[model samples]
Target: MDRRALPDDDTVATALALALRAPSRGNSQPWRWQITPNSMHLYLDRSRSRPVIAGEERDVLLGCGAVLHHLSVAFAALGWATIVHRMPNPDDDDHLAAVTAVPRRPTNQDIAMSAAITRRRSDRRLYSDWTAPPGYLGLLTERAAALGAMIRLLRDRSGGSRAFEPRPTTQGWAADSAFGSPGPYDLENAAAYWTTSTHSEHAPAGSAAADEIAEPDHADLLLLATPNDDRLAHLRAGEAMSAVLLTATNIGLATCPLSAPLDSADQRLRLRHDALDDTAHPQVILRVGQAPDATDLPPLTPRRSLAEILSPVHA
Candidate 1:
């Protein structure tokens, strides 16, 4: 394959389409793409950024990072390898990352992960009590480490494995803690938080409070972290996150990305001290387990159209 061979318009569109499937906070899809003959520029759609939960743009950058990784995976599966230059432009803060695709033979690993893209679902419902296989969590950690991020397995006070815990009632969450007033972004996060955290009669059939797991001891909690906290690190963390999630899907494990605990400075600090032992900056938490067989998996969440997010490269 010729590294410089320009992919057809349809090919470019197809790759970008797969990339947009990358999950974001509240499904805000806070990203834009510019495609040229040689490269794809990833930009943060500031308009879609959630000020309430992502006032510092941390979540926005992380989401963009996931898109960047997804683009690379899509291209690789289509016989193109991507060389990513993150935060390449200082003048354009919104220019989160640039991915230059070079023609290459797709590796079996690449194809497998790409296929997992569509199969992967953020399952918030209660996972089965079955424990993840012994070496499974290590594989996920290795995947993240390959992408310049670290994965820390969180343990309970009794030295047992702990997973998704319900949002504590005493934990202070306000509309204006980091951002003022309720906006679309705030509303979206709040609604998602409520839907996942609470277990009321109106809750979806299989839905249960995160803390209500019958076997919390069997749950696997992995924290994605980086040595430093910055734009590039957050972007890399997101990429690592996508890798882990897709890999989990390929292996038949159910997973969900948790970000609420890392949204606030206080919460993040506490997590660093308690869970991480003040070692690395935690980026996101992942809940991993075997999904129940009795319940049917939910359909994939909706995504924005290609026309709504893609544009031609400007001179």
Candidate 2:
């Protein structure tokens, strides 16, 4: 077999470019990548992270996980197999992973998912009515499962997923972390349609909202979870997040990762009883649906430069 595909300088540089496109809170890009002679190191840049609560830093780790997965996918697509050692140093929490790329032929799935890196967009425009075949969602579940995470469909009593639409029967939440305080809203017909509850008061203005007016959504609500709520579990959830999202994008679905409302443990416990019966710790709530007209899709979110996020590995 042909085995000429080692990750040289150009390949590593290209892979890192694609990988850095992974999503993060407020586009914070809370990660640092350092290149070595034979490996790429992933680190959690605490300085770049902006945890809403000092104690709850799952979002930051999850973002790192997404980039980690993206890097792996990028390497695979570039004809190299990735050897990933997650949390390589127990003593150093910042040492997230050490990845080595081995030369090999890429698979069809690898090429497709890698191409999805640039195509993926978190479009927040109002979705028109849509339906995904059971297999489509099942594939997504499999992708998440492959990375030690699970995706639970947040369906109502009728066994159907709920959209980001107001419901008079349920309580509303109106908190935007950027605004520093929870804003006002209509309790009877709240605008924070997708990601909030009575106790959640720190979600962003776009994802959850701090007032009664915001974007309208008719997308499926999916709770992405893992077995434990520790740092590693959150990171795995983020990896699974990248996998599922890329798969969704590859299959013509528009995706959005909502991290709020469930930002608080109280809200998560409430959602636990309301949605899942398992003991999994929820990390991200993904909104999946058909993309709106090309003209209506929101502009892409900006990103950090390669120099800002990448550097040489320190001894």
Candidate 3:
């Protein structure tokens, strides 16, 4: 492959095609792309976000974030290293990310993740009642941390609507890297810049609400929480979600995104007060466990054609 400062039209189109497989709420695939002279831009196509109660669904950020990571994985597999600029435009909320693809040899790890994208599926069927080994859970946390987010294992859900119980995860955010990274929503000065409008890291702990946890079941649930609950944070959580899901798929595991539970304002409030101790905002709860049989994974869900997601101005 010829080296180029930025990938050309065909190369970008190829990656975008693969990126379309990124998971979204109900496979809504609410995102758009624009390949400019020097970089590829990602946007939230709000028209397809599928708002529940009101406007501008928050899960759209996560969906876009998944596609963002998927794009990077595809580029890497195609022998290109992408330097991503997340939230490049603070003035425009729709502009979620801008990625520049630099041609380079792909690594083994890159190829693995890219391959996982195709094998991955949202398994809504019941996951096997197996405890995910600590080693695998560590890898899942690492994947989330790599993208400036974190994951915490929730007490296994048997199917109760009670507050999510903390399973005591070993993952923590690298505040330095997350805040140091470029673009808007910098967290270096988090004290001054961020507020606890959503969920908080400083809420009171040991409350009566936090102590009540239901019994365990056949589910392995992980909460994809972020330090801040802003749109940018939601997007980062989405990217982390994609990485965790892909990692799980690569290692022979099943995943189901449980965003519907938190859709209710009351449920989210209960989770914050009861489960997390209000220490972090829960973006999405993922059910990760072994499928009954690896050979019997769910079939691939339908996706929009490349033409639908790409900029209409271009071919």
Best by lDDT: 2
* Residue-level error in angstroms, candidate 3, position 91: 3.2
How well is each residue in 1-315 modelled by candidate 1, as lDDT tens digits?
A: 645544778888888889888988878889988876667788889988874453587787778888889988998999988888888999988888877766899999999999989888777655556746668878998999999998877632232544333343333334323442211121114433322223232233443333343333233667889988988888898899999999898888877787765666876787777766787788887777777652477578888999899866667
lDDT of 2 at 7: 68
- Cα lDDT tens digits, model 2, 1-315, are 744434678888899989988988767788998877767889998888878677788888988999999999998998988988999998998999999877789999999999999988876544546777669879999999999998888742222544322222222333443344333221111123343342134444454243522433456767788888899998999999999999999998888777755656676776665565646777877777777674455566677888988867557
Q: What is the lDDT, from 0 to 100, of the residue 292 in candidate 3?
A: 62
lDDT values for all models: 0.72, 0.73, 0.71
Candidate 2 off by > 4 Å:
1-6, 156-174, 177-216
> Where's the lowest-lDDT run of ten residues in candidate 1?
179-188
**Cand. 2 Cα-lDDT:** 0.73
Candidate 1 local distance difference test against the native = 0.72
Q: Residue 141's C-alpha lDDT in candidate 1?
A: 88
Candidates sorted by TM-score, descending order? Answer: 1, 2, 3
lDDT of 3 at 83: 92
Model 3 gets an lDDT of 0.71
lDDT of 3 by residue, 1-315 (tens): 654457777887888889999988756788988877678899999888775458546677888899999999999999999998989998998988988877799989899999999998877544556756769988999999898777777645344334564221111112313433211111101111111111123222442212221212255667778878888888999889999999998888877776654656766776776767888778777777777677987788888998777785464
